[model samples]
Target chain A: MSVKLKALTKSIWVFHLAASPCNNCDIEILDLLTPRFDIERFGMQLVGSVRHADAILVTGSMNRKARIRLKRVIEQAPKPCFVIALGNCACTGEMFAPSYNQMKPLDEVVPVDAYIAGCPPKPEAMIMGVVALIEATLAAAKK
Target chain B: MKGWGKMSDKATAKTTIIPIGPYHPLQEEPEFFKLHVQGERVVKLEIEIGYNHRGIERLAEDLTYDQVPFLVERICGICSCSHPFACVNAIEDVGGVEVPERAKYIRMFTGELERIHSHLLWLGLAGHFLGYNTVWMWAWKYREPVLDLFELMTGNRNHYAMFKPGGVRRDFYEEDFPRAARLLDDLLRPLIMFRDVALQDPVLQARTKGVGVLTREDCVELGALGPTARASNYCIDVRKDHPYAAYDKVDWDVVCTSNGDVFDKVVVRVLEMVESAKICKQCLEKLREVDDGIDCNLKEIPPGEGMGHHEAPRGEVFHYVRSDGTNRPVRYKVRAPSFMNVPTNNRACVGYTVSDATITLAAIDPCYCCTERTAVVDADSGKQIMTWKELLRLSRQKTERLLEKYNSRMDRIWT
Candidate 1:
């Protein structure tokens, strides 16, 4: 792993962006911070500002209105920022995939580094997906 | 400003507007609130929503009756069961289908369990908003077992796909009752502890009590539901007022508090948790007496319109379904509790400070994702003065000040 990538893995602050989502995915994201799952132990914390974040955790599907805001948020984040798509809606648009309002999936809107797939993926799955994303980033940097 | 000219002439010169989230960290769902304040006191509050609009009702038109349950389940994760239950109830009402007695018990069990988890989740969030980290941790920790039970029974923690048109998708096995009862028994101690903390904690009382006052008359006029209305001493629980499922058969009292403030909202939710636990235990005992039977029997829905309303964790989750004797529904309307409760903020927040307004807005347990919808325009300078985080910090700072005051008092008493 490159020195920068290795250092990046030490602490990753995520800003949760809700693009039109059913709340199941958002609750699961919050659940990760609670005592049982406790994602803070891994040095992954949720920050209030997108500017202070190393990663953007996007939940929900990208609707026409939210798409504009999502773009602005992605652009505002510093370079080397990763996007982790959480839940089926974010990754695949799931139930709302064909709706007139929904524009695109998370990847089409912003390049996603990792995808956690579930109706609303469990906290354990979320942690594993995030950890794997960090490892993959480090591996890519080395290559 | 374009919009400020219409403001009350008395406070026109002094008001400064602070915007709270179309996409703010404090909000789990995307909602925008424009708080017009005069020296930290909120004079006028404007709410803008629709950021999370998936048009599920419109989408339901394309999906069949069976498919709509899973679709409506996604309306809000916390109240997932309520929507599907309401939807299924509406379909059953249209078709005139008889759900087996056992299925009714199962539906009640899942609905009550959802209530327990959702209330705990809200309590934890409320504690977090109040700057009480310990309460947040403890409440969420206790909530895990409820989710575990959901996973064990319905196969998913959040969106339990157990509801169908006539009945339910899954049935509880005879062996599961003993373990379910045991788990519920375990939850009682934590619930009591949470209740005690909410009742006796000086800081909590200072932070919440009398902060956001909603009158009983206002609650009724505004069409508030569940604990939001109940907290205001408006006794209108769907279970008691219009019992569906096995609610009429089971015995549980509606929890009501007269204060109509944020503290009363907390009180109503905590007390309701106790009631929910009792209902769950009773349902378990009753389930053992019923014979094993099929949970759902698919029957063609005749051409008719029917309404289904259930007491969701937040409030009344009302679903209206119209069928044309086809497989799909022609019109499906969902009115979640937050829909009715959020607008009441217009009246509830006016007399409070900005710090208190945060908790007051939260007191309704406003589901931004369910509402998914906001825009903030400053009336005075046409520039945004405060972000949602700043508003959250303002709210948290009040609690910190209260804690400091409490600590100093303790120190003086000790000396």
Candidate 2:
């Protein structure tokens, strides 16, 4: 029973948060859950609430509203939680960075453990990033 | 004694109070409602919105025409193409630029693909609220073909980035057309099957039929447009009434319903997907008939204000922009269908059970996560809370209570 539960915990359940991102990251995020990429097969489920998640996957850069929500979700996540920043928008705010409402890389607002870079990263690339994060989570558990 | 007797002529009445928003999940944008209820009937509903506001309209004013397409596309990802397409179409229309024939055909194809995917997405979301996760999963699975086509043609899903002021930013070659056609044909059966199951299932019908019903009288007074308007038996469609792009050239019927319940809305969207597929097939045939040309001409856009409307999967999407003839727009306004329909919540869900309310409200084709923000707050004092987890729990509890009240009321009325 203990072993089975440990395995479950080792596989990270991701809680996704979006800022003022274009629709690109949204679909890329959706693709993460579907069967083709199948991030869930790795036990990486897309969870509903922040508390239940092992890592928070953030897309888009920080907007005024997103900044507050990002802090809330990050703070709510349990200890030793990982963060995977998806898309160029979350990393550099891309073209939307200089806009009146947006802030720079999500890391400026919250500490991030990994980055998945693309205009909007492809689904396969998103899967790879999640897999890497799960391994990192498992490694940390071993430690 | 005379003064005391004079004051006895008037009487004051008390009314029931109901709260509907600030946290209630809605299909449209976030809005708050305070309804005065008397025995399952609404006397008056006071509304408050701007809670989910991010000021996209204000932000659009500062962007260039080229930049505005990308910015506007962010308004609603489900209908991501519709925004940029409408923006560019309006810009081009005002500028007196005709997109290449091939570009127009491609636009039609992508627009139809978007319709297919967006409707399927709504179907999935609608299914999730009704505790039917299987339908959600299945609908989303079939939706992948549309997304996959987007990736194959435009190099990305969601925001295709294909639209330019005069034409498309990208073009398809001889080889790409056959591959896309093959993929689309492969996807048709699954879509038809899903539609059949969704429409015929007794469980789905029971949950949706006669729930959150909006009469035709309510629709016009509320200014409801698109599927929401059509569901109430209004024969209004931007594509048909104000034919733009290749809609004039394409042959299809506007799928509508008379029963303005959740089921009718679902039927309209599902049938619309079939129409969208037919349109896609038509675009493919047209593409085969047309010759290759430059997708866009990097032309200068003169300063002007233009209003453009496109039928998104949800409903009518209106884009208003003012260009300064300096490649940037001075003012931009987006009227997403969901934004317009957000006000109709009290009318739609007033008599329905709260659980049914979720299904019915979402049936209007609401864009949920894109148009909303979540914050943890104290229920008693309305103070900001420390943990989202606690807030999430509280919000769920509130919804559950509302659902219970709604169910109990239904029981009383029916039994």
Best candidate, DockQ-wise?
A: 1
Report residue B228 deviation for candidate 1 (angstroms).
Answer: 0.7
Interface RMSD of each: 3.5, 5.2
- Considering the two chains of model 2, state its CAPRI-style docking category: acceptable
Q: Which segments of candidate 1 are over 4 A away from where they belong?
A: B1-13, B372-415
Q: DockQ, in order, for the candidates?
A: 0.56, 0.24
Candidate 1 residue-wise lDDT at A143: 77
**Which 10-residue window of candidate 2 chain B scores lowest in summed lDDT?**
B22-31
Model 1 residue B227 CA deviation (Å) reads 0.4
* Reference-based lDDT, residue B248, model 1: 89
The CA-based lDDT of model 2 is what?
Answer: 0.71
Instruction: For candidate 2, write residues A1-143 as lDDT tens digits.
Output: 23433464566787766655554676667666766666777677777667887777777656665566568768988866778788887777766666655645688778888899986787887877766766665666675
Q: Distance (Å) between predicted and true CA of A14, model 1?
A: 1.2
Number of clashes found in candidate 2: 2
lDDT of 1 by residue, B24-141 (tens): 8788887678999987788888776556778787789999888999998888888889889899889898877878888888898999999999999999999888878788889999
lDDT of 2 by residue, B246-347 (tens): 888989999878999888888888888888888988898888888757455656876555778788776787776666567777556566776556556668
Residue B282, candidate 1: Cα error in Å is: 1.1
